[model samples]
Target: MNSCATSFVFLRRSGYAGLLWVLLLSASANTLASPVSGTLSAVGSNTMAGLILRWGEALSQRHPDINLQFQASGSANAPSALITGTTRLGPMSRQMTDTERRAFTQRYGYPPLELKVARDALVVIVHRHNPLAELTRQQVDALFSTTRECGANAAINRWQELPATQDWPFGAIALHGRNSASGTYGLFQQRALCGGEFRPTLSQHPGASAVVAAVGESPGSIGYAGYHHLTPNVKAVSLINAEGQAIALSENSVQSGDYPLSRYLYLYVNAPPEQPLPTAEKALLDLIFSPEGQQIARSAGFVPLSETVRQQQAHW
Candidate 1:
Protein backbone atom coordinates (compact mmCIF):
# COMPACT_ATOMS: atom_id res chain seq x y z
CA MET A 1 0.00 0.00 0.00
CA ASN A 2 2.85 2.41 0.80
CA SER A 3 4.45 2.02 -2.60
CA CYS A 4 1.17 2.45 -4.46
CA ALA A 5 1.81 6.18 -4.75
CA THR A 6 4.56 5.51 -7.28
CA SER A 7 3.27 2.26 -8.78
CA PHE A 8 1.17 3.62 -11.63
CA VAL A 9 1.54 7.08 -13.08
CA PHE A 10 -1.49 8.55 -14.86
CA LEU A 11 -2.44 11.71 -16.69
CA ARG A 12 -4.50 14.38 -14.96
CA ARG A 13 -5.85 17.15 -17.13
CA SER A 14 -4.02 20.40 -16.45
CA GLY A 15 -5.88 22.52 -18.95
CA TYR A 16 -8.35 22.07 -21.79
CA ALA A 17 -7.58 23.79 -25.09
CA GLY A 18 -10.37 22.46 -27.34
CA LEU A 19 -8.20 20.28 -29.59
CA LEU A 20 -4.96 20.23 -27.55
CA TRP A 21 -4.70 19.88 -23.78
CA VAL A 22 -1.92 20.29 -21.24
CA LEU A 23 -1.95 16.99 -19.34
CA LEU A 24 -1.06 16.82 -15.67
CA LEU A 25 0.25 13.59 -14.19
CA SER A 26 -0.63 11.97 -10.88
CA ALA A 27 0.06 8.88 -8.74
CA SER A 28 -2.45 6.50 -7.18
CA ALA A 29 -1.36 7.66 -3.73
CA ASN A 30 -0.05 11.02 -4.92
CA THR A 31 -0.33 14.39 -3.19
CA LEU A 32 -2.17 12.60 -0.41
CA ALA A 33 0.67 11.77 1.94
CA SER A 34 3.59 14.17 1.93
CA PRO A 35 6.65 13.21 3.97
CA VAL A 36 7.22 15.01 7.23
CA SER A 37 9.63 14.93 10.22
CA GLY A 38 7.88 13.57 13.30
CA THR A 39 6.76 10.03 14.09
CA LEU A 40 3.18 8.78 13.99
CA SER A 41 1.45 5.47 13.32
CA ALA A 42 -1.97 4.59 11.93
CA VAL A 43 -2.57 0.86 12.12
CA GLY A 44 -5.60 -0.91 10.67
CA SER A 45 -8.11 -1.23 7.85
CA ASN A 46 -6.55 -2.08 4.48
CA THR A 47 -9.79 -0.75 2.96
CA MET A 48 -9.04 2.78 4.17
CA ALA A 49 -5.39 2.80 3.09
CA GLY A 50 -5.65 4.69 -0.19
CA LEU A 51 -7.96 7.34 1.21
CA ILE A 52 -5.82 7.94 4.29
CA LEU A 53 -2.56 8.07 2.35
CA ARG A 54 -4.12 10.73 0.14
CA TRP A 55 -5.16 12.76 3.18
CA GLY A 56 -1.77 12.26 4.82
CA GLU A 57 0.02 13.72 1.82
CA ALA A 58 -2.24 16.73 1.79
CA LEU A 59 -1.87 17.15 5.53
CA SER A 60 1.91 17.20 5.29
CA GLN A 61 1.95 20.36 3.14
CA ARG A 62 -0.05 22.24 5.76
CA HIS A 63 1.90 20.96 8.76
CA PRO A 64 5.39 19.93 7.85
CA ASP A 65 6.47 19.63 11.46
CA ILE A 66 3.97 16.85 12.14
CA ASN A 67 4.43 13.43 10.60
CA LEU A 68 1.41 11.15 10.48
CA GLN A 69 1.91 7.53 9.54
CA PHE A 70 -0.62 4.74 8.89
CA GLN A 71 -0.87 0.99 8.44
CA ALA A 72 -3.50 -0.91 6.46
CA SER A 73 -3.47 -4.32 8.08
CA GLY A 74 -7.19 -5.08 8.53
CA SER A 75 -10.24 -3.75 10.39
CA ALA A 76 -9.87 -6.11 13.37
CA ASN A 77 -6.46 -4.64 14.12
CA ALA A 78 -7.77 -1.14 14.86
CA PRO A 79 -9.35 -1.53 18.30
CA SER A 80 -6.62 -3.88 19.42
CA ALA A 81 -3.91 -1.42 18.46
CA LEU A 82 -5.70 1.39 20.24
CA ILE A 83 -6.08 -0.68 23.40
CA THR A 84 -2.42 -1.59 23.42
CA GLY A 85 -1.33 2.01 22.92
CA THR A 86 0.35 1.04 19.69
CA THR A 87 -1.57 3.51 17.54
CA ARG A 88 -3.50 6.72 18.15
CA LEU A 89 -5.44 6.51 14.94
CA GLY A 90 -7.29 3.33 14.03
CA PRO A 91 -9.41 3.17 10.90
CA MET A 92 -12.18 0.61 10.69
CA SER A 93 -14.78 -0.39 8.09
CA ARG A 94 -17.27 -1.55 10.74
CA GLN A 95 -18.32 -0.58 14.21
CA MET A 96 -16.13 -1.81 17.07
CA THR A 97 -17.62 -4.86 18.71
CA ASP A 98 -18.79 -5.03 22.31
CA THR A 99 -15.80 -7.19 23.21
CA GLU A 100 -13.41 -4.68 21.64
CA ARG A 101 -15.08 -1.74 23.35
CA ARG A 102 -14.90 -3.44 26.73
CA ALA A 103 -11.16 -3.90 26.36
CA PHE A 104 -10.68 -0.24 25.43
CA THR A 105 -12.72 1.02 28.36
CA GLN A 106 -10.83 -1.24 30.76
CA ARG A 107 -7.53 0.04 29.42
CA TYR A 108 -8.29 3.73 28.93
CA GLY A 109 -10.94 4.45 31.60
CA TYR A 110 -13.13 5.59 28.67
CA PRO A 111 -14.36 4.08 25.48
CA PRO A 112 -12.14 4.92 22.55
CA LEU A 113 -13.60 7.81 20.58
CA GLU A 114 -14.98 6.86 17.21
CA LEU A 115 -15.70 9.31 14.40
CA LYS A 116 -17.59 8.13 11.33
CA VAL A 117 -15.15 8.65 8.49
CA ALA A 118 -16.96 7.47 5.39
CA ARG A 119 -19.72 5.25 3.99
CA ASP A 120 -19.16 2.01 2.07
CA ALA A 121 -21.25 -0.70 0.50
CA LEU A 122 -20.13 -4.22 1.21
CA VAL A 123 -20.71 -5.95 -2.12
CA VAL A 124 -20.67 -9.51 -3.32
CA ILE A 125 -18.97 -10.02 -6.67
CA VAL A 126 -18.63 -12.82 -9.17
CA HIS A 127 -17.15 -13.22 -12.62
CA ARG A 128 -18.83 -10.78 -15.02
CA HIS A 129 -19.82 -13.70 -17.22
CA ASN A 130 -21.95 -15.28 -14.50
CA PRO A 131 -25.63 -15.04 -15.47
CA LEU A 132 -26.93 -14.70 -11.92
CA ALA A 133 -29.20 -11.69 -11.46
CA GLU A 134 -29.51 -11.27 -7.68
CA LEU A 135 -29.17 -13.07 -4.36
CA THR A 136 -31.61 -13.03 -1.49
CA ARG A 137 -30.29 -12.57 2.05
CA GLN A 138 -31.46 -16.11 2.76
CA GLN A 139 -29.85 -17.58 -0.34
CA VAL A 140 -26.58 -15.87 0.51
CA ASP A 141 -26.83 -17.37 3.97
CA ALA A 142 -27.36 -20.84 2.52
CA LEU A 143 -24.46 -20.45 0.09
CA PHE A 144 -21.97 -19.16 2.68
CA SER A 145 -22.84 -20.92 5.91
CA THR A 146 -23.87 -24.21 7.41
CA THR A 147 -26.74 -22.88 9.52
CA ARG A 148 -29.82 -22.16 7.40
CA GLU A 149 -31.59 -19.70 9.67
CA CYS A 150 -32.78 -17.36 6.95
CA GLY A 151 -36.11 -18.80 5.72
CA ALA A 152 -35.02 -19.27 2.10
CA ASN A 153 -31.58 -20.81 2.74
CA ALA A 154 -31.22 -24.55 2.15
CA ALA A 155 -27.43 -25.02 2.31
CA ILE A 156 -27.32 -24.48 -1.44
CA ASN A 157 -24.06 -25.04 -3.27
CA ARG A 158 -24.76 -24.83 -6.98
CA TRP A 159 -26.18 -22.25 -9.36
CA GLN A 160 -29.13 -24.49 -10.23
CA GLU A 161 -29.88 -24.90 -6.53
CA LEU A 162 -31.09 -21.32 -6.20
CA PRO A 163 -34.79 -20.73 -6.76
CA ALA A 164 -34.04 -18.27 -9.57
CA THR A 165 -35.94 -18.72 -12.85
CA GLN A 166 -32.98 -19.31 -15.18
CA ASP A 167 -30.74 -22.33 -14.73
CA TRP A 168 -27.79 -23.20 -16.95
CA PRO A 169 -25.29 -25.95 -16.20
CA PHE A 170 -22.63 -24.45 -13.93
CA GLY A 171 -20.14 -25.92 -11.49
CA ALA A 172 -20.59 -25.84 -7.76
CA ILE A 173 -20.45 -22.31 -6.37
CA ALA A 174 -17.02 -21.33 -5.04
CA LEU A 175 -16.97 -19.12 -1.95
CA HIS A 176 -14.25 -16.60 -1.13
CA GLY A 177 -14.23 -13.88 1.48
CA ARG A 178 -12.10 -11.94 3.93
CA ASN A 179 -10.33 -13.74 6.72
CA SER A 180 -11.35 -13.39 10.37
CA ALA A 181 -9.46 -10.12 10.68
CA SER A 182 -11.81 -8.25 8.41
CA GLY A 183 -14.74 -6.30 9.82
CA THR A 184 -16.51 -6.93 6.52
CA TYR A 185 -16.18 -10.62 7.18
CA GLY A 186 -17.85 -10.22 10.56
CA LEU A 187 -20.57 -7.88 9.36
CA PHE A 188 -21.47 -10.25 6.55
CA GLN A 189 -21.82 -13.10 8.96
CA GLN A 190 -24.21 -11.09 11.09
CA ARG A 191 -26.26 -9.66 8.23
CA ALA A 192 -26.02 -12.07 5.31
CA LEU A 193 -25.58 -15.21 7.34
CA CYS A 194 -28.06 -14.14 9.98
CA GLY A 195 -25.62 -14.84 12.83
CA GLY A 196 -24.66 -18.18 11.29
CA GLU A 197 -21.02 -19.25 11.10
CA PHE A 198 -19.21 -19.22 7.79
CA ARG A 199 -18.86 -22.66 6.34
CA PRO A 200 -15.50 -24.33 6.83
CA THR A 201 -15.14 -24.61 3.05
CA LEU A 202 -15.11 -20.87 2.47
CA SER A 203 -11.75 -19.65 1.16
CA GLN A 204 -10.68 -16.73 3.29
CA HIS A 205 -8.31 -14.10 1.94
CA PRO A 206 -6.49 -11.29 3.68
CA GLY A 207 -7.83 -8.22 1.91
CA ALA A 208 -10.49 -6.88 -0.45
CA SER A 209 -8.38 -6.94 -3.63
CA ALA A 210 -7.41 -10.55 -3.11
CA VAL A 211 -11.02 -11.58 -2.52
CA VAL A 212 -12.25 -9.71 -5.60
CA ALA A 213 -9.37 -10.95 -7.75
CA ALA A 214 -9.81 -14.59 -6.82
CA VAL A 215 -13.49 -14.48 -7.66
CA GLY A 216 -12.92 -12.56 -10.89
CA GLU A 217 -10.42 -15.10 -12.16
CA SER A 218 -12.51 -18.13 -11.29
CA PRO A 219 -15.67 -18.43 -13.33
CA GLY A 220 -17.65 -20.12 -10.56
CA SER A 221 -16.27 -18.09 -7.67
CA ILE A 222 -18.24 -15.58 -5.60
CA GLY A 223 -16.84 -13.22 -3.00
CA TYR A 224 -17.48 -9.96 -1.19
CA ALA A 225 -15.45 -6.79 -0.76
CA GLY A 226 -15.75 -3.06 -0.28
CA TYR A 227 -17.35 -1.31 -3.26
CA HIS A 228 -13.96 0.32 -3.99
CA HIS A 229 -12.44 -3.02 -4.85
CA LEU A 230 -14.92 -4.01 -7.57
CA THR A 231 -13.09 -4.63 -10.84
CA PRO A 232 -14.23 -4.72 -14.46
CA ASN A 233 -13.97 -8.48 -14.69
CA VAL A 234 -16.27 -8.89 -11.70
CA LYS A 235 -19.89 -7.81 -11.36
CA ALA A 236 -21.55 -6.82 -8.08
CA VAL A 237 -24.72 -8.83 -7.53
CA SER A 238 -27.77 -7.12 -6.12
CA LEU A 239 -28.83 -8.47 -2.72
CA ILE A 240 -32.40 -8.76 -1.52
CA ASN A 241 -32.75 -8.00 2.16
CA ALA A 242 -35.11 -9.67 4.62
CA GLU A 243 -37.67 -7.01 3.66
CA GLY A 244 -37.93 -8.58 0.16
CA GLN A 245 -36.73 -5.54 -1.81
CA ALA A 246 -33.74 -6.19 -4.04
CA ILE A 247 -31.27 -3.33 -4.09
CA ALA A 248 -28.07 -2.79 -6.02
CA LEU A 249 -24.92 -1.88 -4.20
CA SER A 250 -24.06 1.76 -4.88
CA GLU A 251 -23.08 4.89 -2.98
CA ASN A 252 -26.62 6.23 -3.03
CA SER A 253 -28.08 2.92 -2.02
CA VAL A 254 -25.59 2.60 0.81
CA GLN A 255 -26.32 6.16 1.95
CA SER A 256 -30.07 5.72 1.72
CA GLY A 257 -30.16 2.45 3.73
CA ASP A 258 -31.43 0.51 0.75
CA TYR A 259 -28.23 -1.48 0.41
CA PRO A 260 -28.38 -4.28 2.96
CA LEU A 261 -24.64 -4.45 3.42
CA SER A 262 -23.90 -0.73 3.69
CA ARG A 263 -21.53 0.18 6.53
CA TYR A 264 -19.82 3.15 8.11
CA LEU A 265 -16.04 3.50 8.07
CA TYR A 266 -14.58 4.87 11.29
CA LEU A 267 -11.59 6.41 13.04
CA TYR A 268 -10.88 5.82 16.75
CA VAL A 269 -8.93 8.20 18.93
CA ASN A 270 -8.32 9.18 22.53
CA ALA A 271 -9.21 12.81 23.17
CA PRO A 272 -8.35 13.13 26.82
CA PRO A 273 -10.94 15.27 28.65
CA GLU A 274 -11.01 18.75 27.08
CA GLN A 275 -7.28 18.66 26.38
CA PRO A 276 -7.18 19.28 22.65
CA LEU A 277 -6.49 16.31 20.39
CA PRO A 278 -2.74 16.09 19.94
CA THR A 279 -1.68 18.62 17.31
CA ALA A 280 -0.80 16.03 14.66
CA GLU A 281 -4.02 14.06 15.18
CA LYS A 282 -6.05 17.26 15.14
CA ALA A 283 -4.62 18.22 11.76
CA LEU A 284 -5.36 14.80 10.29
CA LEU A 285 -8.99 14.64 11.49
CA ASP A 286 -9.63 18.20 10.32
CA LEU A 287 -8.40 17.22 6.88
CA ILE A 288 -10.62 14.13 7.00
CA PHE A 289 -13.81 16.14 7.54
CA SER A 290 -12.79 19.07 5.37
CA PRO A 291 -14.31 19.40 1.91
CA GLU A 292 -10.94 18.55 0.41
CA GLY A 293 -10.56 15.38 2.49
CA GLN A 294 -14.09 14.23 1.75
CA GLN A 295 -13.48 14.88 -1.96
CA ILE A 296 -10.44 12.64 -1.88
CA ALA A 297 -12.53 9.96 -0.16
CA ARG A 298 -15.17 10.29 -2.89
CA SER A 299 -12.50 10.02 -5.58
CA ALA A 300 -11.31 6.84 -3.87
CA GLY A 301 -14.85 5.40 -4.34
CA PHE A 302 -16.39 5.93 -0.89
CA VAL A 303 -19.51 7.93 -0.09
CA PRO A 304 -18.87 11.13 1.80
CA LEU A 305 -20.04 11.23 5.41
CA SER A 306 -23.53 12.62 5.74
CA GLU A 307 -24.02 16.26 6.75
CA THR A 308 -25.62 15.07 9.97
CA VAL A 309 -22.72 12.74 10.60
CA ARG A 310 -20.21 15.51 9.86
CA GLN A 311 -22.02 17.82 12.22
CA GLN A 312 -21.79 15.15 14.91
CA GLN A 313 -18.12 14.62 14.14
CA ALA A 314 -17.69 18.36 14.65
CA HIS A 315 -19.20 18.21 18.11
CA TRP A 316 -17.25 15.10 19.04
Candidate 2:
Protein backbone atom coordinates (compact mmCIF):
# COMPACT_ATOMS: atom_id res chain seq x y z
CA MET A 1 0.00 0.00 0.00
CA ASN A 2 1.02 3.59 -0.54
CA SER A 3 2.02 6.02 2.23
CA CYS A 4 -1.41 7.68 2.18
CA ALA A 5 -3.11 4.34 2.72
CA THR A 6 -0.70 3.51 5.51
CA SER A 7 -1.43 6.86 7.17
CA PHE A 8 -5.19 6.22 7.09
CA VAL A 9 -4.73 2.78 8.64
CA PHE A 10 -2.56 4.28 11.35
CA LEU A 11 -5.12 7.02 11.99
CA ARG A 12 -7.87 4.43 12.55
CA ARG A 13 -5.78 2.55 15.09
CA SER A 14 -4.22 5.49 16.95
CA GLY A 15 -6.75 8.35 16.53
CA TYR A 16 -5.70 12.02 16.80
CA ALA A 17 -2.85 11.23 19.21
CA GLY A 18 -0.85 10.21 16.10
CA LEU A 19 -2.07 13.29 14.15
CA LEU A 20 1.29 15.09 14.15
CA TRP A 21 3.29 12.22 12.68
CA VAL A 22 0.65 11.49 10.06
CA LEU A 23 0.61 15.15 8.99
CA LEU A 24 4.40 15.21 8.92
CA LEU A 25 4.49 12.28 6.50
CA SER A 26 1.83 13.84 4.26
CA ALA A 27 3.51 17.28 4.29
CA SER A 28 6.93 15.85 3.52
CA ALA A 29 5.48 13.89 0.64
CA ASN A 30 3.95 17.03 -0.88
CA THR A 31 6.09 19.93 0.35
CA LEU A 32 6.20 23.00 -1.83
CA ALA A 33 9.51 24.75 -2.41
CA SER A 34 9.83 28.09 -0.66
CA PRO A 35 9.12 31.16 -2.73
CA VAL A 36 12.06 33.56 -2.80
CA SER A 37 10.06 36.79 -2.38
CA GLY A 38 6.41 37.86 -2.40
CA THR A 39 3.61 39.32 -0.32
CA LEU A 40 0.79 37.09 0.99
CA SER A 41 -2.23 39.09 2.18
CA ALA A 42 -5.40 37.72 3.76
CA VAL A 43 -8.63 39.43 4.86
CA GLY A 44 -11.46 38.50 7.27
CA SER A 45 -12.33 36.62 10.48
CA ASN A 46 -11.32 38.46 13.64
CA THR A 47 -11.87 35.16 15.48
CA MET A 48 -8.95 33.72 13.49
CA ALA A 49 -6.87 36.87 13.81
CA GLY A 50 -4.55 35.46 16.46
CA LEU A 51 -4.05 32.07 14.82
CA ILE A 52 -3.36 33.57 11.37
CA LEU A 53 -1.02 36.17 12.88
CA ARG A 54 0.96 33.35 14.51
CA TRP A 55 1.05 31.49 11.19
CA GLY A 56 2.27 34.64 9.43
CA GLU A 57 5.01 35.07 12.02
CA ALA A 58 6.13 31.49 11.47
CA LEU A 59 5.96 31.96 7.70
CA SER A 60 8.11 35.10 7.93
CA GLN A 61 10.72 33.27 9.99
CA ARG A 62 10.99 30.49 7.39
CA HIS A 63 11.05 32.83 4.38
CA PRO A 64 12.58 36.18 5.32
CA ASP A 65 11.78 37.53 1.85
CA ILE A 66 8.02 37.12 2.10
CA ASN A 67 5.94 40.01 3.41
CA LEU A 68 2.80 39.04 5.34
CA GLN A 69 -0.38 41.10 5.64
CA PHE A 70 -3.71 40.33 7.28
CA GLN A 71 -6.96 42.22 7.94
CA ALA A 72 -9.48 40.87 10.44
CA SER A 73 -12.66 42.90 10.08
CA GLY A 74 -14.92 39.81 10.26
CA SER A 75 -15.93 36.72 8.24
CA ALA A 76 -18.44 38.78 6.26
CA ASN A 77 -15.60 40.71 4.66
CA ALA A 78 -13.81 37.61 3.34
CA PRO A 79 -16.31 36.68 0.62
CA SER A 80 -16.38 40.19 -0.76
CA ALA A 81 -12.56 40.40 -0.73
CA LEU A 82 -12.23 37.10 -2.57
CA ILE A 83 -14.93 38.07 -5.06
CA THR A 84 -13.26 41.39 -5.75
CA GLY A 85 -9.87 39.64 -6.02
CA THR A 86 -8.51 41.96 -3.35
CA THR A 87 -7.03 39.00 -1.47
CA ARG A 88 -5.81 35.54 -2.42
CA LEU A 89 -6.26 34.10 1.07
CA GLY A 90 -9.31 34.69 3.28
CA PRO A 91 -9.30 33.25 6.77
CA MET A 92 -12.87 32.68 7.94
CA SER A 93 -14.37 31.25 11.12
CA ARG A 94 -17.35 29.95 9.18
CA GLN A 95 -18.05 28.69 5.67
CA MET A 96 -19.14 31.09 2.96
CA THR A 97 -22.88 31.42 2.54
CA ASP A 98 -24.74 30.34 -0.61
CA THR A 99 -25.23 33.92 -1.79
CA GLU A 100 -21.54 34.66 -1.30
CA ARG A 101 -20.63 31.51 -3.24
CA ARG A 102 -22.87 32.56 -6.11
CA ALA A 103 -21.29 35.97 -6.22
CA PHE A 104 -17.81 34.43 -6.35
CA THR A 105 -18.89 32.03 -9.11
CA GLN A 106 -20.22 34.97 -11.08
CA ARG A 107 -16.94 36.84 -10.68
CA TYR A 108 -14.53 33.95 -11.28
CA GLY A 109 -16.74 31.34 -13.02
CA TYR A 110 -15.81 29.00 -10.14
CA PRO A 111 -16.57 28.83 -6.44
CA PRO A 112 -13.88 29.89 -4.02
CA LEU A 113 -11.75 27.01 -2.70
CA GLU A 114 -12.50 26.35 0.97
CA LEU A 115 -9.81 24.66 3.06
CA LYS A 116 -10.78 23.50 6.56
CA VAL A 117 -7.63 24.03 8.61
CA ALA A 118 -8.83 23.69 12.21
CA ARG A 119 -11.76 23.18 14.57
CA ASP A 120 -13.08 25.21 17.53
CA ALA A 121 -16.06 25.55 19.82
CA LEU A 122 -18.05 28.50 21.07
CA VAL A 123 -18.02 28.55 24.89
CA VAL A 124 -20.36 30.28 27.27
CA ILE A 125 -18.41 31.77 30.14
CA VAL A 126 -18.94 33.44 33.50
CA HIS A 127 -16.83 35.02 36.20
CA ARG A 128 -14.88 32.41 38.18
CA HIS A 129 -16.74 33.22 41.40
CA ASN A 130 -20.16 32.36 39.95
CA PRO A 131 -21.34 28.94 41.12
CA LEU A 132 -23.66 28.29 38.15
CA ALA A 133 -22.77 24.95 36.61
CA GLU A 134 -24.46 24.06 33.30
CA LEU A 135 -27.16 25.59 31.08
CA THR A 136 -29.61 24.03 28.67
CA ARG A 137 -30.03 25.29 25.10
CA GLN A 138 -33.29 26.99 25.99
CA GLN A 139 -31.74 28.70 28.99
CA VAL A 140 -28.88 30.04 26.88
CA ASP A 141 -31.35 31.38 24.32
CA ALA A 142 -33.58 33.00 26.89
CA LEU A 143 -30.67 34.59 28.67
CA PHE A 144 -29.23 36.23 25.55
CA SER A 145 -32.15 36.77 23.22
CA THR A 146 -35.22 38.89 23.77
CA THR A 147 -36.84 37.21 20.81
CA ARG A 148 -36.19 33.80 22.31
CA GLU A 149 -36.50 32.04 18.95
CA CYS A 150 -35.21 28.77 20.41
CA GLY A 151 -38.56 28.09 22.16
CA ALA A 152 -37.56 29.66 25.46
CA ASN A 153 -40.88 30.48 27.08
CA ALA A 154 -39.63 33.65 28.74
CA ALA A 155 -36.59 35.83 29.23
CA ILE A 156 -33.95 34.77 31.75
CA ASN A 157 -32.99 38.11 33.31
CA ARG A 158 -31.59 37.40 36.76
CA TRP A 159 -29.12 35.02 38.40
CA GLN A 160 -31.85 33.64 40.59
CA GLU A 161 -33.97 32.45 37.65
CA LEU A 162 -31.83 29.37 37.06
CA PRO A 163 -31.93 26.59 39.66
CA ALA A 164 -28.14 26.57 39.99
CA THR A 165 -27.91 30.18 41.13
CA GLN A 166 -31.13 30.65 43.09
CA ASP A 167 -29.29 31.68 46.25
CA TRP A 168 -27.03 34.26 44.52
CA PRO A 169 -27.41 37.89 45.60
CA PHE A 170 -27.16 39.18 42.02
CA GLY A 171 -30.37 40.79 40.84
CA ALA A 172 -29.63 40.91 37.11
CA ILE A 173 -27.35 39.02 34.73
CA ALA A 174 -24.85 41.18 32.88
CA LEU A 175 -24.62 40.11 29.22
CA HIS A 176 -21.79 40.57 26.73
CA GLY A 177 -21.49 39.51 23.10
CA ARG A 178 -19.87 40.24 19.73
CA ASN A 179 -20.98 42.90 17.28
CA SER A 180 -22.89 42.19 14.05
CA ALA A 181 -19.68 42.30 12.01
CA SER A 182 -18.26 39.22 13.70
CA GLY A 183 -18.78 35.71 12.37
CA THR A 184 -18.84 34.70 16.01
CA TYR A 185 -21.93 36.88 16.39
CA GLY A 186 -23.53 35.40 13.28
CA LEU A 187 -22.96 31.80 14.37
CA PHE A 188 -24.18 32.46 17.90
CA GLN A 189 -27.29 34.12 16.53
CA GLN A 190 -28.01 31.14 14.32
CA ARG A 191 -27.23 28.27 16.67
CA ALA A 192 -27.77 29.54 20.22
CA LEU A 193 -30.41 32.09 19.43
CA CYS A 194 -32.13 29.92 16.82
CA GLY A 195 -31.94 32.66 14.19
CA GLY A 196 -33.29 35.19 16.70
CA GLU A 197 -32.22 38.69 17.63
CA PHE A 198 -30.18 39.46 20.72
CA ARG A 199 -31.66 41.38 23.63
CA PRO A 200 -31.34 45.14 23.22
CA THR A 201 -29.37 45.21 26.46
CA LEU A 202 -26.64 42.86 25.23
CA SER A 203 -23.28 44.66 25.26
CA GLN A 204 -21.56 43.98 21.95
CA HIS A 205 -17.80 44.11 21.54
CA PRO A 206 -15.67 44.25 18.42
CA GLY A 207 -13.65 41.08 19.09
CA ALA A 208 -13.59 37.88 21.09
CA SER A 209 -10.92 39.15 23.50
CA ALA A 210 -13.03 42.15 24.37
CA VAL A 211 -16.11 40.03 25.04
CA VAL A 212 -14.05 37.72 27.25
CA ALA A 213 -12.49 40.68 29.01
CA ALA A 214 -15.86 42.25 29.68
CA VAL A 215 -17.19 39.02 31.16
CA GLY A 216 -14.13 38.55 33.33
CA GLU A 217 -14.43 42.02 34.80
CA SER A 218 -18.10 41.88 35.69
CA PRO A 219 -19.07 39.78 38.70
CA GLY A 220 -22.67 39.11 37.61
CA SER A 221 -21.66 38.55 33.99
CA ILE A 222 -22.37 35.88 31.42
CA GLY A 223 -21.08 35.83 27.84
CA TYR A 224 -19.90 33.64 25.00
CA ALA A 225 -16.64 33.61 23.09
CA GLY A 226 -14.33 31.18 21.34
CA TYR A 227 -12.96 28.45 23.59
CA HIS A 228 -9.40 29.73 23.11
CA HIS A 229 -10.25 33.06 24.67
CA LEU A 230 -10.71 31.53 28.13
CA THR A 231 -8.59 33.15 30.80
CA PRO A 232 -7.93 32.53 34.49
CA ASN A 233 -10.42 35.20 35.55
CA VAL A 234 -13.34 33.42 33.92
CA LYS A 235 -14.71 29.88 33.71
CA ALA A 236 -16.81 28.21 31.02
CA VAL A 237 -20.31 27.01 31.80
CA SER A 238 -21.01 23.45 30.71
CA LEU A 239 -23.77 23.23 28.09
CA ILE A 240 -26.35 20.51 28.50
CA ASN A 241 -26.82 18.39 25.40
CA ALA A 242 -30.11 17.13 23.96
CA GLU A 243 -29.63 13.96 25.95
CA GLY A 244 -29.62 16.02 29.20
CA GLN A 245 -25.91 15.38 29.67
CA ALA A 246 -23.64 18.30 30.50
CA ILE A 247 -20.89 18.73 27.91
CA ALA A 248 -17.80 20.52 29.13
CA LEU A 249 -15.14 21.90 26.81
CA SER A 250 -12.35 19.43 26.22
CA GLU A 251 -10.15 18.32 23.32
CA ASN A 252 -12.04 15.06 23.01
CA SER A 253 -15.51 16.64 23.31
CA VAL A 254 -14.85 19.32 20.68
CA GLN A 255 -13.25 16.88 18.23
CA SER A 256 -15.98 14.28 18.75
CA GLY A 257 -18.76 16.89 18.22
CA ASP A 258 -20.14 16.29 21.70
CA TYR A 259 -19.58 19.99 22.27
CA PRO A 260 -22.76 21.67 21.10
CA LEU A 261 -21.07 24.63 19.47
CA SER A 262 -18.27 22.85 17.58
CA ARG A 263 -17.24 24.63 14.36
CA TYR A 264 -14.64 24.44 11.58
CA LEU A 265 -12.18 27.24 10.85
CA TYR A 266 -11.39 27.76 7.17
CA LEU A 267 -9.02 29.41 4.69
CA TYR A 268 -10.96 30.36 1.56
CA VAL A 269 -8.57 30.56 -1.38
CA ASN A 270 -9.21 32.42 -4.64
CA ALA A 271 -7.43 29.82 -6.78
CA PRO A 272 -9.28 29.33 -10.05
CA PRO A 273 -10.11 26.12 -11.91
CA GLU A 274 -7.44 24.38 -14.04
CA GLN A 275 -4.54 26.29 -12.51
CA PRO A 276 -1.91 25.79 -9.83
CA LEU A 277 -2.12 27.87 -6.64
CA PRO A 278 0.26 30.85 -6.49
CA THR A 279 3.69 29.98 -5.13
CA ALA A 280 3.44 32.07 -1.94
CA GLU A 281 -0.13 31.00 -1.22
CA LYS A 282 0.71 27.34 -1.87
CA ALA A 283 3.76 27.61 0.38
CA LEU A 284 1.61 29.11 3.14
CA LEU A 285 -0.85 26.19 2.86
CA ASP A 286 1.96 23.64 2.84
CA LEU A 287 3.29 25.15 6.04
CA ILE A 288 -0.18 25.33 7.55
CA PHE A 289 -0.68 21.60 7.04
CA SER A 290 2.85 20.77 8.15
CA PRO A 291 3.70 19.62 11.66
CA GLU A 292 5.13 23.01 12.59
CA GLY A 293 1.98 24.79 11.46
CA GLN A 294 -0.27 22.34 13.28
CA GLN A 295 1.79 22.93 16.40
CA ILE A 296 1.13 26.67 16.07
CA ALA A 297 -2.60 25.96 15.82
CA ARG A 298 -2.56 23.72 18.88
CA SER A 299 -0.58 26.31 20.80
CA ALA A 300 -3.16 28.93 19.90
CA GLY A 301 -5.84 26.63 21.49
CA PHE A 302 -7.40 25.52 18.20
CA VAL A 303 -7.79 21.83 17.36
CA PRO A 304 -5.75 20.53 14.43
CA LEU A 305 -7.49 18.76 11.58
CA SER A 306 -7.28 14.98 11.63
CA GLU A 307 -5.18 13.22 8.98
CA THR A 308 -8.19 12.12 6.94
CA VAL A 309 -9.42 15.71 6.68
CA ARG A 310 -5.86 16.86 6.05
CA GLN A 311 -5.59 14.52 3.06
CA GLN A 312 -8.69 16.02 1.42
CA GLN A 313 -7.45 19.58 2.04
CA ALA A 314 -3.90 18.72 0.98
CA HIS A 315 -5.17 17.49 -2.38
CA TRP A 316 -7.44 20.52 -2.76
Q: Evaluated with TM-score, which candidate comes out highest?
A: 2
Candidate 1 structure quality by residue, lDDT tens digits, 96-135: 8899999999988887888998888888888888887798
| C-alpha lDDT of all candidate models, in order | 0.79, 0.87
Q: Against the true structure, candidate 2 has what lDDT?
A: 0.87
Per-residue lDDT tens digits for candidate 2, residues 113-137, read: 8899888999999998899889999
Stretch of 10 with least lDDT, candidate 2: 27-36
Q: Model 2, 170: alpha-carbon shift in Å? A: 1.2
For model 1, the local distance difference test gives 0.79
lDDT of residue 228 for candidate 1: 87
The TM-score measured for candidate 2 stands at 0.85
Which pairs clash inside model 2?
none
State how far residue 109 of model 1 sits from its true place (Å): 2.6
